[model samples]
Each structure stands twice: as C-alpha cells, then as structure tokens.
Target: MTSQNSRQTLIIPALGGLYARLNDGVETLLRVIAGGFLAVHGSGKIVDPFGASEMVEGLGFYPGAFWSPLLAATEFFGGILIALGLLTRPAAFAGMIVLLVTVWFHWVTMGQGFSGAEKSLLWAAALAFFVVRGGNRHSIDARLGKAF
Candidate 1:
C-alpha cells in the first residue's frame, strides 16, 4: 500500500476505538450525574418522608402514608444503585416511572404546561435511555457480566 493509504487505514481504526471509549465514558458520566442528582434531591424527602403525604395524596396515589417512604427509598437508594451501575436498568426503569408521574402532575394537575413538566420529561427520557442501553463497558454491570 502507498504511505497515504497505510496511514488512512491505521488512523481510521484508531479513531473508531477512541470513539467507542469516548461513548462509554460519556454514558458513565450521564449515569453518575443523573443518579447523584436524584439522590440529593430525594434527601429532603427522606428526612421528612411523610411530609409529602398530602401532595402525593393529591396526586391520587392514595394512602400517601404508605407510598411516601417507598417513593423516598426508590429515589434515594435507586439513585445510588444506578450511579454504581449495579442493577442499573431496574433502577432507571423505576426512576422513569416516578418521573412520568411527575410529568403528569406538573402538566395536568398543576396546569403548568410544557415549561413546568419539562424537567421531568427530560429525566424520563434519560431514564428511558438507560432502561434501553443498560450499563456500558465502564459500568459495574459490565464487570459483573450482567446484561440488566
């Protein structure tokens, strides 16, 4: 092969490999940021688990006394699990459900329109991505040889 062709062949493969690593790194970063934010945001709910009883009941979840702690645990602990890429898909799936509910609550219940529901919509999309993609090579799921 000519010098230029040889260089092209080498460079192309090198770039492909770099791109794969970069994609994995970006995925890991997204997981960490999303999960960490959920954990921190849920911290207040954990402290006063029953404080949301009225709001949750207003959302028609019913018996907020029962679901309050469950919501708190799902966000806080599930966020930790997702951040670690341990049972990531399940955690993300659960988070997605919570976010969807928030979307409905903000848009329909509060009549806040797209602007109010936008954050929950974005979070739901992120969680949905994780639900589909699971954890990448840099994740604990990958290390454990688990698909989900």
Candidate 2:
C-alpha cells in the first residue's frame, strides 16, 4: 500500500481512541464556562434593564428597550441551550452575535479593546466545533437519536 493508505490505516483507530476522550474533556469544560458566562451576563441585563437600555442605545441598535429584552433572552436562553448541549450551534451563533455587538459597542464606538474576547472566542470556537461534530458521542442529540 502507498504511504497515504498506510497512514490512514494507522491513523483512523488512533484518532478514534484519542478524539473522544479529548472532545469529552474539552466540551465539558467549554459548556460549563459558556453557561456560566451567559448566566452572569444575562442576569445582569435582566436585573438592570435601564443600564442595558443605555448600552443598547450606545450600540445604536434602535429601540433600546427592545434590545435589552432580546439581548437578555439571547444570553439567558442561549446559555441554557449551551448548558444542555441542545441546539448548541444556533445558541453559539446567537452568542457570537451578542458578543460581536458588545465588542462593537465597546471597541468600535467606545474606542477600546479591553473586554477580552478570549472567552467569547473560545466559546464560539467550541460551539462551532459542536456544530460540526453534531454533539456526537455525548450529547442530548445523540441520546435522543439512540432512544428513538
């Protein structure tokens, strides 16, 4: 066999063994972190609608009041999805949009880049991973599939 075929022969099994453990470890960690971040941020907005309104206005999203509710729900509800690993891709995409708006509010309008996109970036990447992986191996999607 050629080198490509030989490489695949050796690689497939090794990848199978290694990827599960690796994905499980990373996904669990990311899910927890993403959930926590959303919960905290959403709670803040829910608790302080006025402050959130000001933020929405600053971001120029129109109807600042409406922005508050949408943002709060996105973070809070999306966080729950992230926690459950259900609809994680959409949730992550929503979350990414939220963060981009926030970043734009702070970085573009306010002229700063200090909020640290690291966690948001990480969460977005992890969510994208799940989107591609389809919550494979250990997820509600998989469980439901097996159950049905």
Candidate 3:
C-alpha cells in the first residue's frame, strides 16, 4: 500500500510540502473571504432591513416585514459570526439556507436556470463546507477552546 507521504508526493512532488504547511492558512483564507463577501453582500439589506419585504413575499415567505429583517440579520450578523469563526457551524448553516433560497429564486422563480443561479450555487457549496468543517486552528473558536 502506498503511504500517505508517497501519495502526496506523487500528486505534486515540488509543491506538496508547501501545500501541507499552508493548508490551514488556506482554509482560514477561504473562510474569511467567504464570510467577508457574504457580509458585504448583505450590508445594503441591513441598512434597509425591511426593503426586501416584497421580495420575500414574492418567494412565499409570509409577512414580508418579519422575514425581510430576519433575512438581513441572517446574512449580515451570521456572516460576521462565520468570519470570526464563532458559532461557525450555525452561521454557515444559516447562510447556506439563504443561498439555497436564492438558488431557487433564480433558477425556478425567475426562470434564469443554471446561468442565473450559478453564483448562489457556488456560495451555498462554500457555506456547506464550513457547516461541516466548522472553523480551523486559526479561528476564534480554536482560540477560545470551544465551538458551537
């Protein structure tokens, strides 16, 4: 049987060692970027939390007033939590749900299909990763020695 070291070397002999050393940092970077972009994307909604009421209602979310603000908070505050790696799993799960809704909205509601829902699809996948992995050693969860 091929040892782990040999398998890694066989894949990329030259950069394998570098990749191993930077794997955690790279994971941290992915988390930060994903969370940061999510926060930025929701920043506008946060300012006018109720502005999406009509949109939410259109998606069959009743009482646009409540759902709109909830969506805003889930995107804005949840993104912050994910970025900080605090409550990472819950935050990511929330974000994933939001992204999935967008996917449906674009793909089925708007009839844009794959071309329109592509970004939401990718974002959902990324959040799914965090939902499963939580934060890494560089995260606040790690520093606090506790994670949820």
lDDT of 1 by residue, 22-78 (tens): 777888999988888988878888898888888889999889998888789889888
lDDT of 3: 0.92
Model 3, C-alpha of 122: deviation from truth (Å): 0.5
Give the TM-score comparing model 3 with the true structure, all chains together.
0.93
TM-score for each of the candidates: 0.86, 0.71, 0.93
Kindly list the per-residue Cα lDDT of model 2 for residues 30-146, writing each as its tens digit: 675776678677887767665677768767777888888888888888777776767766776777788766555555576666565545555556655655654444556566663
Best lDDT goes to which candidate? 3
Each prediction's total of clashing residue pairs, residues at least 3 apart in sequence or on different chains, is 0, 0, 0
Sorting all predicted structures by lDDT, with the top scorer first, yields: 3, 1, 2
Model 1 scores a TM of 0.86
Better of 2 and 3 by lDDT: 3
Candidate 3 runs further than 4 Å off: 1-9
Q: Which prediction has more favorable TM-score, 1 or 2?
A: 1
